[model samples]
Target: MMAPDVARVESAIEQAARRGDFDNLPGAGKPLDLPAAHDPDWWINQRLASGEIDSQALLPVVVLLRKEFERREETLAALPDERAVREYAEDFTQRVHQDRRANPFQRMLAPAWDPEDAVARWREVREPRPAPTAAPTPEPVAESRRRRWWPLRRRG
Candidate 1:
């Protein structure tokens, strides 16, 4: 037997469906199949699979999954086995490697260009140098070595 609130929600959903309110609604929170663009391992293996994502291109996808996980983390943690998480992570890694290999130029160019070195070189080129100024004149030492002030003096 369903709870009364659940039954009421079901009825409302059914009514909404009948009235075309839910007819063309897309799966708003569903993960994109993303076999090629987002899940390159799936693209490489030619089998679409649900998994973790760690690619820069798939950052948005990861963010969405993270939000979902955060929302349902307790439920996920309560599951008997966490093997699925491992499997998913492996699948994501494979996809990312496959995607990385697809674009040889990007892989080659990324490491070839060093932004940090370029910035350092630019600073070296544009650094300001101190202006030429007259040498500092040293004060003359007193010829006599007499004490400037007596050790003790009484005021009159």
Candidate 2:
């Protein structure tokens, strides 16, 4: 699958923040010792001034921040867990099998999802896959052939 778009993620985080989604995140309603500065660039500059190095360059740091924000938004979005994911897969599969549109957006999302093959991907994650065998089994023991051949060819 294609890597998530950094810009899109950042934009989504900003949109969510504007809509108060972050404040509602799980474990986030409690008072936070959030940074005094609200502006991210200002926060970065402050960290720099304090001799705290952001090892990742600005773009990457922004992306990381965006992902954290997205996680918070997702948590607040009250999305389902593995069971829900499994249920969704089963439902979607049934819909497809029945030649129905499970969701209109699925058509748009399907192309990006197709190349990676979700069932195999989920199996890889869920199952303990066995390591590949190196070679076939060796031949088993022979009967009296080895002993007789050795006696016949004994050094005289």
Candidate 3:
């Protein structure tokens, strides 16, 4: 037996349907727009696409750290000097260690990043790029050899 509230809701829905409240509605007879392949994170993707959730916050801490490691050059390039880069690398390494300690189960996923190695990488990325060689100047053409086209005049 249905509860009184459920019975009342069904009756209300039936009354609305009879009154044509469900007719002429948007996509009433159209097939659902489903993905070609099933996606487990469809709702999360929709929320991300609709700007309802911050993509950065949605990533796992380990994943974030890995991304930071991958983009270390870009991060280091923004620093003012070697000292700042060193500090940042140290801080990043400390955070990695702390995360490993806090989540021992995730230790396998969060590889330890060496601060010294990060400093070396920063130096390599900071190296100045060689100046581009100047293009060879073209020899000037003789005035007599240069052709000039005259605009056509209307004969009419």
Better of 1 and 2 by TM-score: 1
Give the clash count for each candidate. 2, 0, 0
Best-to-worst TM-score order: 3, 1, 2
Stretches off by above 4 angstroms in model 2 are 1-43, 48-82, 86-117, 135-156
Index of the highest-lDDT prediction: 3
State which candidate, 1 or 3, has the greater TM-score: 3
The C-alpha TM-scores of every prediction are 0.23, 0.21, 0.51
lDDT accuracy of residue 74 in candidate 1: 44
Cα displacement (angstroms), candidate 3, residue 61, comes to 0.6
Q: Model 1: residues >4 Å from true position, as ranges?
A: 27-54, 57-122, 125-156
Candidate 1 per-residue lDDT, tens place, 18-39, comes to: 8978655576557755544564
lDDT of 2: 0.51
Which 10 successive residues of model 1 have the least lDDT summed?
107-116
TM-score of 2: 0.21
lDDT of 3 by residue, 1-156 (tens): 999999999999999999999999977999755667999877677678879888899777888888888888799778877778778877888888887778888644655666677678778888998999999999999999987698778899
lDDT of 3 at 52: 87
True-vs-predicted CA distance for residue 5, candidate 3, Å: 19
